[model samples]
Target: MSFPGVRRCHAHRRAPLHAGHRRRTFGGRAGLVLAFALALALGVGGTAAYSALYGSIPTAEAQDRVVVRGGVVRLGTHVYLHANGSHGAIGITRVALVKKCHLRVYLDRQPGDRVVAAVAEEDEAMARLGVQAGISGGIDVVDVRLYRAGRRVCANDRIFGGRSNLWISVTTLARTPRKPATPAPAQPTVPAAPAPPTSSVEPAAAPG
Candidate 1:
């Protein structure tokens, strides 16, 4: 019961665990959990803010209204009305191809007055014959000729001091021509039968 080595072994086995080691392990785990929760909160807040801002943005049609209010350009098919004495330029914002197309201008004018109209490629110089207005005249149909590549392919014009409307129609003249018909083969002709042998017997009887 008094051996020194056995007493030393027994003391080692009863040694107490250090409290600082336990605190270090627990603190590290807690720090990681706190960091994760903070990151998740920030992400959720950012997403909510972005969604609210996106919902407030205007739609395509709404933006078009804003552009129209700014008076930049009328972006639709527009019908303009002018009284008998009104004279000015009318701008058509619709885009169209001039080649192989026809522009028709219908006018109602006073009988005695004449309305001079012209068609050009630009809005400012739209009236190729200068600014002309009708004074006293009846309703008239004015035809504006448009040319493309030195050939008359379309019609466009401007009218002043008249009750009128504009319309466009495409022409079929610009279409490609049909191919020529193939020549028919010549038919073979049959030889006519020789006249039946003249009755030599009849001629002999007449002579007798």
Candidate 2:
């Protein structure tokens, strides 16, 4: 055997080099993972920026307005968005009685203008309509409205929404003058029998 000390030194030098190589390899892989994460974040940011700038609204509209009179209800479809810098829409958001908590509400807007309205799929939609119509009292509880350019555009069916009023609901219902109720038909009465051929009446004389 050559010197024991020399052998030990040689072994220590080789082990450190191997460990350093492994450490460098791990660090390189860690760096790559971090770079990939950054790239993904940047990509998402870019997409958001493009969407905000381009105004790429969905071709399909949200939903139509539910025209009603004086009903404070939940509405979800009419998502008011600011189209131009000057024009904007206001919408009322209320809670619904249904389990899923959809929305019951009233709506009014320009003929083609779309407001945000909630959409239900199967049985949920049916039940919602039933309840909304069933609770058809003329009074609307919540008052909310949407205004554009300082003009009233739409509102909660029962209350004021910021600036607008629930004035357009008249169109959804008929307002005819109520006629007075007619009197009941008179009852017929039977006259009392003339007292059984009146005991006092003289009997007719027999022709003798």
Candidate 3:
């Protein structure tokens, strides 16, 4: 009932439309796969970067348990002065002497010992470990601990609490050698009173 030329034209049109639809479907699937791969790669990279940056930092619990093994803590001799040069003789600074701010600390599971160093202020140390008024309670002296309140701290590493240099908590405080006292000068010896000039003649044998 239809002409052969018209039938051929309809078939050609339908063929191109089907082919375009298939191409679009394949392209969308390829884009989705590529997007998923890129996202996964970025996620993995971010995780690794985070780990690398923060892995070396010890946990809060680990820092809390760090024990002060031994170190020299001395009372500061310098007097504190206000901006206007007031309050010069008020008090002394409590200091913990370290070689270079590196402290030897003991941990729970460590074999020997570990060194911790910091160059922070008194407030930072106080916040890390609460300060007490005295060393009687066996407090750990890592950075700063207030054994005596209302005292300025001199050492950059740890702060002790009291004025007592005899720290019972520390294993042993290295003692400073005392300089020997100088001997007193000797008194000049007065020459014995010159013997009365022996008379050329011994007084004639005591006047015979």
Q: After superposition, how far is residue 1 of candidate 2 from its true place, in Å?
A: 99
Candidate 2 per-residue lDDT over residues 1-208, each given as its tens digit: 6785575444444445565466444347676555556656677454434433443433232112233322222233332221245433233233233333222343332333322222222123323333222222122322233333455432132222222212112222212222457999988998877866535778899999
Cand. 2 Cα-lDDT:
0.34
Error of 1 at 40 (Å): 99
lDDT of candidates 1 onward, in order: 0.33, 0.34, 0.35
lDDT of 3: 0.35
lDDT of 3 at 127: 40
Best lDDT among the predictions, by candidate number: 3
Give the lowest summed-lDDT range of ten residues in model 1.
67-76
Per-candidate TM-score against the hidden true structure: 0.20, 0.18, 0.17
Residue 114 shift from truth in candidate 2, angstroms: 22
What ranking emerges by TM-score with the best candidate at the front? 1, 2, 3
